[model samples]
Target chain A: MEEIKKHVLDCSNLNCPMPIVRIAKTIRTIEVNEQIEVTATDPAFKADVEAWIRKTGHLLISYAEEGRSRIAIIEKTK
Target chain B: MEDQKLKEYIDALVEEKVNEKTLAFQNQLENIQQQLSTVQVRENEKITMLVTSFELDKVIPAFIIANGAASFGMDVTLFFTLWGINALKEKSIYKGKNIKEKMITMMLPSNPKSTTISRLNMMGVGTSMMKMMMKENNIETLPDLIDLSIDMGAKLIACQMTMGMMGITTDEIRKDVDFGGVALYIEEASESNITLTF
Candidate 1:
């Protein structure tokens, strides 16, 4: 069986600097090639998570609005 | 006999000396009075108060000010609201494990949860490490800090709207807190010259 290529992080209950902060912490523990999915409810996370991806050299895979929240997926680039 | 008495009395009379004083004394008195008037009504500047909503990195500066203001004799208030309320929580007394974690949270962009983990991670081995470090460093735990804040008359209030939305009752807040509506905080902010949101 192929290794699990992606992991999902549900950070909907958190506020600003929280979703990205937790994602960053979770990312630090993950394998180099694995990707992480971040689901957040904070309206400010759309801009912040994207900004973090851009600034930290992470791959912005996809971001979509699901129901009342947003799902953002970022792949570790380095 | 009357002529002899008049001569004797006239002989006893003495000449008076002429008094000498300068108009400069009057000028000196006027100058002293003018100087005294200028010295009396001098004013010290009115104090400024700063109110802040706490975040990890966002709140450190404000916390420094809140603690330091008393030292400077300036009035400072930290108004915790929403997620900002976490800073005042009993669980938030943790510092980062390493110097890097400390500097990152204290100086750079960092979150509250990671800060707790990082601080605990650095303490020593496991659960006991934090307690050991607390003892070794002579630092109070989060609960102690909260209690101290209460004893010191630091205003710690829960946001009524946030509590209602989050389904937290007034009892969930620290018993020492003075709870009320947004109007209370607004009244505080309006009274304060400076209001900050984090």
Candidate 2:
């Protein structure tokens, strides 16, 4: 796997769609192909982010669990 | 008439009927596909709101939907008419030029954050308790939701007629709000697949 440049977004304690919403807001700022590392505390977001990425056609590079939080690296595909 | 001629005539009639039915079926299929395309386009393009109530419960859900739609790249317009117009007032209740307006704003919770719950509001205690519960649960308050919606590109439109009736001038409302009438709401709603009246 190739190394990808990423931006970090903290969505601590924010529920459900908030984490995904924040990711949607931030993804537009960076250029296409650049990834976002979204850190979310809500347990539901593990599935929610995947669902959103699938619906929006964004690339979900990876999703990792760190302590109690989940981190998803999503790449924008133009 | 000869037997061969009779048989040929019957065959032609049967072929014509089949062709007609096939054409009709194809046309119906095309119509259904067109309708589906229209619905899909409507789904992705816009979400418009006709909010007639400023009650915390109503406005909270409205804001949630508006912000959700806007975050997903849909154009969101919230039309505030009637009591819904109150949601556009500034956070701090200022002394109004008109006494009636001033008194009303003052008597109200002074801001959307302080808006009373629509049900079981025990002399504002319910509102406070609900706010506390929301805070404890990491839920976004009404003010936070409104700001997030604005940041996500949702348009807040105040109905001109309602504002006139309530004696609220454009300047009295918050700076971020736009002015509109029924026609504007209709125009926005027409383009939106999801149009809700609160």
* Maximum-lDDT candidate: 2
Give per-residue CA lDDT, model 2, range B1-198, as digits (tens): 699999999999999999999999999999999999987865467889989888888998998788777767789999998888878887544445478766765676546866888987899888888888988989888888888898899999999988776666676688888998989989998988789878
- Summarize candidate 1's per-residue lDDT along B41-134 as a digit string, tens digits: 5421112223233433454444433433322223445566665554543332123235543433344212223223224444435435555664
Predicted candidate 1 versus true structure: per-residue lDDT over A1-78, tens digit per residue = 787589989987565444665676677778776888888887887887776776567788889998868998788766
Model 1: per-residue Cα lDDT at residue A13:
56
lDDT of 2 by residue, A2-69 (tens): 77678999998997558877988898898889899888899898878877776788899898998988
Worst 10 residues of 1 chain A by lDDT: A13-22
TM-score of chain A of each: 0.89, 0.89
The interface root-mean-square deviation of each model, in the order shown, is 14.6, 1.6
RMSD of 1: 23.7
Q: Give me the displacement of residue B136 in model 1, in angstroms.
A: 5.9
